[model samples]
Target: MPASTPRPVGASGPELHDHLTCVAAPATWLSPPDGRLAGGPGGLYVADRRVLSRLVVTLDGAEPEPRDAETLGADRVRFTAARGALAVERVRTVRHDGGTERITMRNDGDGIATVTFEVTAAADLAQISDVKAGDPPPPETPLRDGAVLTGPDGYEVRLEGRTEAALVLAPGDRFTTTLTVRAAPPPVPGFRPAPPDGPPPWARTPLTVRSADPRLDALVAQGVADLGALLLADEGDLYCAAGSPWYLTLFGRDALWAARLALPLGHEPAAGTLRTLARHQGTGHDPVTEEEPGKIPHELRPAYAPGRLPPVYYGSVDATALFVVTLAEAWHWGMPAEEVEALLPAAERALAWLGTFEEFVSYRGSAERLPNQGWKDSSDGIQHLDGTCATPPIALSEVQAYAYQAAMLGADLLEAYGRDGDRHRSWARGLAARFRARFWLEEGYPAIALDGTGAPVDGLASNAGHLLGTGLLDRDEEARVARRLGELNSGWGLRTLTAEAAGYDPLSYHRGSVWPHDTAIAMLGLSRTGHREQAAELARGLIAVAPAFGHRLPELFGGQARRDGAAPVPYPPACRPQAWSAAVSPALVTVLFGLHRDATTGQVSATPLPGFGPMTVTGVRAGGRTLTFTTEDGAPASD
Candidate 1:
């Protein structure tokens, strides 16, 4: 299948925020507004496929009216509903391979009540891409198992109690029934979930945050919970998946960025992520999946068809560089020297791949490749200022920055690990010089990228903001870039593109949307470049909007200019509880405190900024020790 425009957000109606998503890593369930895994945008999903599409409940042929719903944990929820004289309590639990829903009905009327219950269930083994595009799935096929609805190739929905039953209950009497849905593949090796008690072996270090602002406090709390729930363990290795419902698998870029932002938590997860990705590093040139020797993959599927799309896709140019960058950062943040040493070869390969590039790292995927392979992978993501799509083999300004950072950091790592890296240092210096001369645009901001033909594709985007701390831009260049990015800020956060840009669309995913994680990175950049006031302002705006979206930021939202008293508009189909979005809270805290660690020196320190108010973050694990940040004495303190 060739890269095509993503289908529009069709008749599924407006973006739904009321729904709850319970994820058990690779296995997740998204419920509709009614709290049932029924037809619309809710189902049991595993291995990137929606297994059970329809699971509706009715009492005496009438839909149950939802009264109250609350998520108990990442994998459990409680729902209260009423249908006529019956009151119902539904507890849904998402497990590793399947889900169980227990329903308890109580007669609410004074007299005895007799009612019939019917659960209409179906399974359509539809790919996640199809589901996200609102493509109608094939018709469900009834299976041979009694009360089971299944599709071909083992997509099954099994029921224990009868699907249709009649029960009589006296006033205050209760009746309970449980239906189980096992969503597994056709006996594929290495696809099964790990044991419940013993998940992939990673340190369960607890990190906590608190602030004087209640909203900010709540946001941090929710973010911690979300990150914990989204952690997945595969073959004794734990890593954070991008998000649920659609993306419940390993993504190289998302995982790398998430791990980088999470340095305050610990280095174990970051170390695990590097090892997990290195295990699948490309070793040959396969254009179909964009494999090249030493390149890290863009994404990894749970299972793969041999002749079809490979299980691992190495289309991203940044992920490889990022992998090297993360390894260096993790080493600085206290990952064991031996563990970091083990990954030095992979880092060398990644750097060697970058050396082969003439100007900057570029994607080599053919027409069948993803239209836009950067962080903004949507169809129209990489368009010119005039709204035309940028041609492929594009050298993104940020990728150059990433490459520059990677080279410098890779050189440091090589030196620390007893390898020759003067060449890497020389290469980084030359690349930074090239970037400064080539990427700057006449509009006072950097062009988004150089198109396939080496022509600049102009856009005042947030991409240049990433250059601040990367050492790619000099002090004055960083200041100018920061000032331009500040103008594009919507008060809510930095928009992806300036509103005045020809291709800007507030609702578009990458064109004009405000992504919390993206803005967080830019804010970090601002802090690094001595723009403390601007960084604090952006932090305050993010805190203000946190409450509107349940204190857990979505993947991205509309880039509507912030007003004095208006809320940020939600982008339809934006992934909530996304890994990077969940990580923004901590990333902001990291920038606000100006936290830094030197693994060689074993020193930790902080310089807190204003607008964050008086706050304390305890139990931050870094440098192989628990450190604390407090602002109780009118100034930030560290221990």
Candidate 2:
């Protein structure tokens, strides 16, 4: 198998693991991991555009040597450095409107200090994609306050800051300089934008976990913090952005899955996510964006340039299905009846779209759409077993599973809410029968997808693992899928492609990478199917790998096996605080604890799996009540 594909024309490696400190707030930006905004890949990003590209600080013609850097929280970073007799500390806070960076210079020597303090700042007004591709930014004008950069159309980058011409300080004295950047002028003089509001209502729903293992505690704490920070509000509703630097915007499939996995936290977040997507549901046909009436959008972001992405794009083949599935899950998890009823129309639309297009969801874009519109959106993501790209209008196997679950679950929700769903129920039965006949292979697994001509594109992949417990597979099929997934497991997590497959690349974005959320999905399915031991093993891999990445799971990592006791290899350029990525921790905890609810009976329970360490999880809210669970000596108990 080829280790890497030739870089696509005009496409470069997405620096997923860019060593930078990202502060996401009213606006978002990246700086050197040491918290230095001294230019480079670290720049201020607002509305998916780079505002300030190069910012450097100098003292007497010398740059400070960074000594230490630490991310204080999701929206704050601090760095310490020194140059000659001056010690410098930089504190950066990302706020709702812009950012406030405070630089403190202290004189350490026992003499008066006089040195020039020059801050060279410029904005390149580049699109985030251009920046990621290493394209040159436009020319910038150095205004007296700062510099302004221009981009295509009327987009503008207004950089504003001030530095004293010279700093004079006595021994032990400190001089502080404040720099601010904004898309618009600050509301008041010296007004520092406040931090984002406290955690959402669902986040406050009393979910807590404590264990003797410090790693477990850290994972839970950081997961909560990161999820809270990733949440974005629109018209009083909340949904998480996909990730930093590249995708800090609404993504239909990503947000849907994240919200579903977060059900253990509270249903309100999921409810808001469902409603938000419904509000933006595609209302008409637009081939440019692949938008069709009733289709859920693949992404929603500020319009940067023509032909890039319209403010909204509805190209995803599975997000529409996943939307109905999430709504159904939320309703069953105890979302209010009125809220669920309000979204019934949107659910009907998504369900109708699911069946109207040739009994399969296919992307409309052949040349213009994202190469692969599913979660694996990278070009050349879907492939036949021979390393050739799967032709367009492809039907991914996992998407069929999503559609099956959506149809059945949507039927349940519609019936429960006194709506006519007989068509959905009947359609689901037919799709499942067709799927079983067409998708299952004699090799004891399912194909990766059905090609444009409806022939099975044979490949052993982790996609089949998502079929577990979705009602599309029988007992025998689920067992085969479970066993096949075990073979694909690198002993750390599930690999997207088996090693024997033709296009396998352990480090590739989709072919053979291990995505945390993907593993979490399969793990949840396994647990639901009564495969506790297998589920436990899957959860263990994620726990074992968490500490390697600061206990914060990244979007995906290399699929190198856990042999000879070597740690899992990292995927360079993966997003660290990715929404679905951070969401895996909670999802894993939910699965291991058997955290599920029965709203019809008003019961919430957890069945602790074996081999897990002694721990107590308190304040878990479900079904309008808070519950606690504890495990000791491999036994489970709850309150």
What are the TM-scores, per candidate, against the unseen true structure? 0.92, 0.91
lDDT of 2: 0.76
Compare the candidates by lDDT and give the number of the best one: 1
lDDT of 1 by residue, 1-639 (tens): 012423233212334455688877777888765687656667777766676777778988888899998878667888899987799998998877778888899998999999998787777777776777677876764422356554555555554555667988999999888877776556565333232244422235455567778987787777766776677765676678888766777889999898888778788668878988888888999977799999998887755322134667887879988999999988988888999999999999999989988667777886465777789777778888889989888888889988999999999889987898889888888887787788888878788988898888897998887787998988888889988888778888889988877888887878888999889989998998899888888888888889888787888887888887777777657777798988887787687777888677978788888756677887678766887788763386656
Candidate 1, clashing residue pairs? none
**Candidate 2, after superposition: displacement of residue 455 in Å?**
2.1
Tens digits of per-residue lDDT, candidate 2, 1-639, equal: 123533223223355453644546435767655554444456777765666666677898878888987767777778899988899998887765567778899999989999898877766666676766666666654533655544555655554567657778899999888888776421322112223355656455546678766777777766766777778876667788787767777888999999988887778778878888898898898888788889998887654422366667887889999999999888888888888899999999999999886566566664465878888777877888888888778888898889889989998889988888888878888888888888888988999888788878788888887888788888878888888889878877999888887888888888888998889899999999888788989988888887777777888888888876566776756776888987886787787677778868868777888787787887676667767788773576667
Cα TM-score of candidate 2: 0.91
Q: RMSD of model 1, in Å?
A: 3.9
List where candidate 2 sits over 4 angstroms from the true fold.
1-18, 109-112, 143-162, 185-198, 202-207, 305-307, 357-359, 364-367, 563-567
